[model samples]
Target: MGSFTLDDVLAVRKRRDSWWTVFLVDPIACRLALLVANHTSITPNGLTRLSMVFGLTSAVCFAQELLIAGAVLFFVSFTVDCMDGKIARLKGTGTPFGLWLDYVGDRLRVLCCAFGIASALYARTGDVIYIVAGAGVVVLDLFRYINGPQLKRVRDTTRAVARENSGAECVFMDELLGASAPGSSTEEVRREFERAGDEDGRELVDLQRGFRAQFPWYDRVRMFLVAHRVRSHLISGIEFHAAVFVVGPLLGAVAWLWTSAVSGALLLAFESVLVYRAWLATREVARAVPVNEREKVLV
Candidate 1:
């Protein structure tokens, strides 16, 4: 076997990776991925497709009440999900189509897992609550997918406008939320804000600061959830399955049901706040920028 190290794995990780991935999942997954990469001729897309198989298999196991089997398969699927990107980076063979396929696979995995769990619980108890919980998960996932990009665009546009007006490079929102890159100096970021003298520039900075103030706790929680492409959606899936596979077996099925339901409701509420805040911040930035600039921002 080819020798690999922790630093080698860390090299492929993104700047704003999720805390769950950074602290728990990646260490093991990355090691496994490196070993597989060194030993085999598999492509990154091959690993991605393999993950989809494990994900669907896990769904089936969950639907059949094979809790331990389902949990094991889910872990395997997630591990491979992490591996595909690492392999892509290692091989330098990543393509846009590969990214698209990975995204589609993720959506499918979530759908299958949620539906399988709901159907399984419904079969056992004949209640509609599980179905509702499952539906809620799907809806929230859709919202997160749709809203996340829009919010990012708004934030990016705001920063661009500020930069144009102030002639200073501003820090990204993720940095303020504590996902700073290595060697990113606080003084440099502070100077960027200090340079914002024009009305549009000042407004942009204020809106960014206000967003941070409004969601201090969310920012903290988001640090751990940040690694996923769709953080909220991924977190929801993790919470649901953790309840089913871990809590269910330990606390009994009844506890799992209630926990999943309550957690889904809470997630929906949290997502609502995020969307609302993003909208408000977008509006503030849009209003501050010139009409032509705003049009460009939207485009």
Candidate 2:
């Protein structure tokens, strides 16, 4: 624990984070990861693979109705998922391939866990409802996955237009929109955005700032629910496992099915909000760019 410092914790934390991770998970896991990073030679990709193993194991436990075991494994899986990136940063070994692996691994883990839980529940009770619930979760997860990159692209393209118009070295749209990497400087992001030359760029910046100011609580909650990274897509994984595998077994099969369905619904709602926000931001950026320039930049 002494090996990890406040700086180390800050190093791995995202510019925008969910409340759960900011307050709970990272406080514990990041330090643990720091210790592992200092003591071992494990690559970030290796840690990513380990997380997948834990996730798959948790899925199997859920399928067996081993609620306690499933919950424990699921938490471990998530903690390790956080650790891999921290470890990568510490080791200075992060790569595009590692990032790709982390994203794909998260998706696979969620899919496996959802299907496993549904299949197990159906086998025990002969209920088609569980299968439907699982399918719904999969679809919602898929949507979240697809929407994430699209949103990022829109944001990036819009920022590029702003940069071109302003001729500023640092546009900092990533920080303004909470898409920056962990440990990015907020002051720097703000300073750059405020320097935008054109009305559209400044308006978009002001709109984002005003939106945050107007709805502080909503902004706080949304940050906790969906942070900058692709793995945010799996935010529901812990809740889903806890509800269906842990709470469900204690309450009964009906409870499990209901919880699974609710988890899917919640994820769908979260992703919908994200998509809407992206649309608004994209429109703002498009309006700022000249129509001729928009066609050139966005494509």
Candidate 3:
């Protein structure tokens, strides 16, 4: 409707995104989204397609071993990639096709960029290790995308069942934790934390299971990360893409290789932790649900 402010743009962004996006890309994207939403007639799909063009051009730059240009363009491409979603949320002009395109386009761009990086590296030095590392990165990325959502679904289902078993009324993860809120800023998140209560049927901090019960050391870490607007997970797929596409291209080949390697390792390690926690939570849910049923029968 009226002119969109920076806050308006940010309000529609994901509650949690890659630290790379929160820090580097959001500054540009938030501003650009504001400008586009207010002044232009461009749809979210338009931005998606525009991002693809930049991404492919970046890939071409990388293929030619134009490291500096490639790095800059990739950053720009990623920033633009972030804008489409924010604009969609702000303007309410998102389409199913846009979502599908955004998802598939991201993977395609990454694969193209991966090919470009590997091709140039192999051409420059003829090292098989580069190709191997690139392949490993691609595989890791694919695994995260494929398994991460399913794991989240399982974890959420476990938590829901556990809460239902214990006769708890508050929803913890979705509201205040995962949902995109207005401003989606650290301040807004803190306000949500303050607003948590059972009296109003709102989100309450669940100390019953999952990481909260098992990992006491993580409480402060989670608080700190959430306050800083970073993901609670130490290293995720976002960091993995950021390392390979951004940090690597800027720092040189060796840094790129090690960064991508370390990023992938960290992502896997964090994912494994989540899986273990989910397993524990599921077992507890199984045991608790039966006990609750028995109590209900006795009553």
How do all models score by TM-score? 0.76, 0.73, 0.83
Clashing pairs in 3: 11-183
lDDT of 2 by residue, 56-98 (tens): 9988987886756776787778788888888777667888899
lDDT of 1 by residue, 3-38 (tens): 656577668776555445666678788888878877
What lDDT does each candidate get?
0.66, 0.65, 0.75
Q: What are the RMSDs of all candidates, in order?
A: 5.0, 5.4, 5.0
What TM-score number comes out for model 2?
0.73
lDDT of 1: 0.66
Cα-based RMSD of candidate 1: 5.0
Ranking by lDDT: 3, 1, 2
TM value for model 3: 0.83
Model 3: per-residue lDDT, tens digit, 1-299?
A: 45888888878988777778888789888998898888899999999898889889989998998877888888888888899999889988899999899988888888888889888998999999889988888898899898888877875775566556665432344235444443355346546565654456644434234655566666456556665677777678777788888888899987888988888888899889877765655554544455655333121
Clashes of each: 2, 1, 1
